[model samples]
Target: MEAKLYDGPMIDAHQHFWQPQINPHPWLAPDVLIPFRYGDYSAIKREYLPPDYLKDATPKHNVVATVYVDAEWDPKDPMGETKYIHTVAEKYGMPNAVVAQAWLHADDVEAVLKAQSQYPLVRSVRHKPAGALSPAEAQSGIRTLMSDEKWRQGYALLAKFGLNFDLQTPWWNLHEAKRLALDFPDTLIILNHTGLPYDRSAEGLKEWHKAMSLLSDIPNIVVKISGIGLPDKKWDINDNRWIVQETVQIFGTDRAMFASNFPVDSLCGDLETIFTGFKEAVKDYSPEDQHKLFFANAKKYYKMKI
Candidate 1:
C-alpha cells in the first residue's frame, strides 16, 4: 500500500535524539536485545541527532515541531538526557517540546521534578511505571511500578510543576492506567505507542481494544497514534489502517494525535513511510480532524508555542 504524501504542517508527537558517546544509554549496549515488537534495533544503536532525523523526515514531512520523549538512557542521570536534548533542540530548531525521564519512585523525586520543571521546554515526564499487572500477565520486562505509594506520591508532584505525564505501558496495564488517570484527574495523561498493543493475535487485539475503550472514558486521557509497527512488524499501510481508524474512533480527533516514534520506528521503515502510512490510514476523515491529528492537538497537549 503506497502512501499518499500529506503536505501539512505536522508535529511529531513523539521521537528521540541520543548521543551514546557523550551520554550513557545502557539500552544501546551491543549485547542488549529488545523484544520482537521493536524488531531488531541494531541499525539505530548509533547516535541519532536532529540533523540525522531531519535528513530522513524533511523530504516527506513538513515537521514544524517535535516532542522529544526520553530515550531510556542511564537512569542514574535523567537530567543529563534532558540537558543534551535541549542543546539538540537549540541547534536543530525542532523537537520544540521535551519529555524528560523521571523515576517517580526515586528518593529525590521532588528535587528531580523541580530541576526538570525549571526548563521551559520540559513539558512532561515519560515514566514507564512498573505497573500493577498480575504475575501471569506480567512479561519478563514488566515491573510492579505505578502501584507503589511512594511513586504515586511522586506522580502527584507533576501537577505542582505544571507538567503532564507521558505514559508508555502495555495493553495489559491500561486498566491500571485508567485508575491513575481517574486518581489524577487534574493531570493530563498522554498514552504512548498506541497503548502498546504488543500482542497482535485476534485475542490480543480484542484485549487491546477493550483496554482502550475503558481508558477512553476518562476525558483527560489522550492517545498517540504511533508505533503500530511494533507488533505489526511488517509495516503494511493496509494492515495499519484499522489500528489507526480504531484509535481515532475510540479517542476521537480532539484527544488523539499523530506521532513518528522515529528512530525506534525507523527499524520498521523510513520516516516517509511512517507519516505517509498515517496519512493514508486517516484519509477518510475530514481535513479539520486530519489537521488536529497532524498538528493542533500536539501543540495544545505539549504547549509547543511553535
Candidate 2:
C-alpha cells in the first residue's frame, strides 16, 4: 500500500532563522564552534533567513506558517534576536509566531520577559533549563534546575504576561519538568525534541519512554515531535518511526504536533526527507488525527492566528 502524505496546511511549531553576520550567535560563530548533536554544522553557520527556509520547505511541503524559536543569539542582549526576527517577519511575511529567548535565572529576566511580551509576534519564551548529563548526576542539587527557587521566581513571571514556555532538555530530566508543570498548572510547557531520545539503545529508549509517560500525565504540558535527527546517522524512517509514533501515543494527538526543527535537522536530511519520514510514520492514522498532528495542534498550542 502506498503511504499517504499529509497534504494539509502545516504550522511548523518550531524552527529558527539566523544571520550571524548581523546578530552574534556565538555558537554559530566561526571560531567558537561548540559541540553539536549533529557533529559539524558548518554548512548551516551561514545566513538562514525566510527565503532560505522557504526554499527548503516549499515545493515539497505546504508550510503555511511557522513559529521561530530563538537561535541562541548573544545572551548579553536577548531582545536582539527577537528584534531581528520581527524585522525578518515584517519583510518576509512568514514566521507567523515566535518563541523568544530569556534566561529564567538571569537577574534581568523580568525586564527581558516584559519586553518580549510586548512584541505581537512573540508567543512564548525558551530558557533551556540546566540539567544533569546523566541520571546519576541528577541529584547533585543543581541550582539552575527547575527546582531552583530563584529560577522559579523568574519562571513565575511568565504567567503574569501570559507567555508559554518552550522546554528543551534531555529525557532523564523530565521528572523535574513533570513537577514544574504541576507547580505552575496555569502555564503551558511545550517540550521540545520529543524529549531528545538520542541514545537509541534498548535501555535508553526504555528510560526515554518512562520519562515521556510520566511527563504526559501533566495536563498543562504539550510536546513537539522534532529534532529527532541522530548524530552520524542518516535520517531514516526505520530509525525514527517508533519515536514519532510513540510520542503521539504518549501525548495523544491533541497534545502533540509535528515540527521541522529545520536547518538544524537539515544536518541529517533535507526538509522534504524529514517531513516525509513524519508523514510515512503515521500514514495509518485517521485523517482527523493526522490533521491535528500536522497542523491543528500547533495552531492551537502556539495560539497562531492563521
Candidate 3:
C-alpha cells in the first residue's frame, strides 16, 4: 500500500540548509555544538538537503512540506541565498516560505523589504543577533545602529512590509525580548528555538520559567518548539520534556508551533527522531490541539497558503 501523508498540510515551518564543504562557514562553534556531544559533528556528514531529509526522516511522521528559514548570512546585500532557495522551493513547488534577514538599520530596512518582495516565500525577517555565541562576520548593524527613534522607524517598516520578525537569540534575553515584542504589537514575532533557554543550573531553570512566563503575556509573541539540540546533556533534543511542557503551559497550542528545525537540528537527531519526540510529547493533547501544534498553528502564524 502507498503511504499516506498527513491529512492537512504537515508544514514544518522551521528548517535550514547549508553545505559546509561548499559554504565552509562556521555558523556556530563546534566546541559548543550539541551534536558533537551526541556524536561526532563531522560524522553527521556535510550539509543537508531534501534527499538527506528523506533518508533520515520517515514519512509516517507526517511532513507533507516545509517552509525554509534562511540559514546563511543575508549577504553583504539582501539577495544571496534568497534567490537560491527560492529557485529550489519553486522548482518542486514547495510551500517554502523563507524568513529573510533584514538588518533594522535606519531607513535601509525599506530596501530590505523591497528585496524580499522579489521572492514569493520571503515572508518574514531575521536579523542575526550582533553578539550571540559566535563572533564571525559583522551583523547587519540594523538593530544596534538604529537608535530608539531608528528602532521605532524600523519597526514600522517591518509592519509595512507585512513581515513577521524571527527572534534568534539565547532565551536568556527574554526580559529585553519581552519589551521588544510588546513594543511592536503589530509585527507578529516568532521566537526561535524556544528562545534558546539556557536552563542547565537550578537558577538557570528557575529564571527561564519566570522570563518565559513574562514573555508569554505579550500577544504578538509566539514560541517555536524547535532547535532543542543542545550539546548540554540536560537539554538534548531527545530530552525535550520540560521545554515542550512549559511551552504548552505558557503559550498553549494557539500561540505555539512545532518545527523540524532540521539540518541544523540534524546536528541532534534525524528528522524522524525529532518528529517522534514532538508527537510523543503532544500525543495526549486533543487532535484539534495536536493539529495546531504540528500544522494548523504554523499556517495561521505565518499566514501560509496551505
Q: For residues 1-306, what per-residue lDDT tens digits would candidate 1 score against the true structure?
A: 333445689999999888766778887887887664665678888888888888988776898889999988789998988888888878888689999999998899999999999987999998888554532555444545666689899999999999999998877777777888899899999999998776677988897898899976799899999988853365778777778899999999899999988888888878888888898888777777789999999999999998
The true-versus-predicted C-alpha distance at residue 12 of model 2, in Å, is 1.0
Model 2 C-alpha lDDT per residue in residues 1-306, reported as the tens digit of each score? 555777888888899988877778889888776878899898888888889998998887899999999988889989988888998999999799999999998899999999999999998999988768776677564423598888999999999999999999988888889989999998999999999998999998998999899976788999999999888888988999999999999999899999999878888988988998899999988888899999999898888888
The Cα RMSD in angstroms, rounded to one decimal, for candidate 3 relative to the true structure is 5.8
Query: What value does the lDDT take at residue 146 in candidate 3?
Result: 20
- Candidate 3 deviant stretches above 4 angstroms: 1-9, 20-45, 131-152, 232-238
Give stretches of model 1 more than 4 Å off. Answer: 1-5, 34-36, 132-143, 230-233
Candidate 2 residue pairs that clash: none
For candidate 1, the per-residue lDDT at 129 reads 81
The prediction achieving the highest TM-score against the true structure is 2
lDDT of 1 at 247: 92
Give the CA lDDT, 0 to 100, for residue 210 in model 2.
92
Candidate 2 segments exceeding 4 Å error: 1-3, 139-144
TM-score of each: 0.93, 0.97, 0.82
TM-score of 2: 0.97
Q: Tell me the lDDT of candidate 3.
A: 0.68
Residue 301, model 1: Cα distance from true site in angstroms: 0.2
- Residue 159 of model 3 has an lDDT of 81
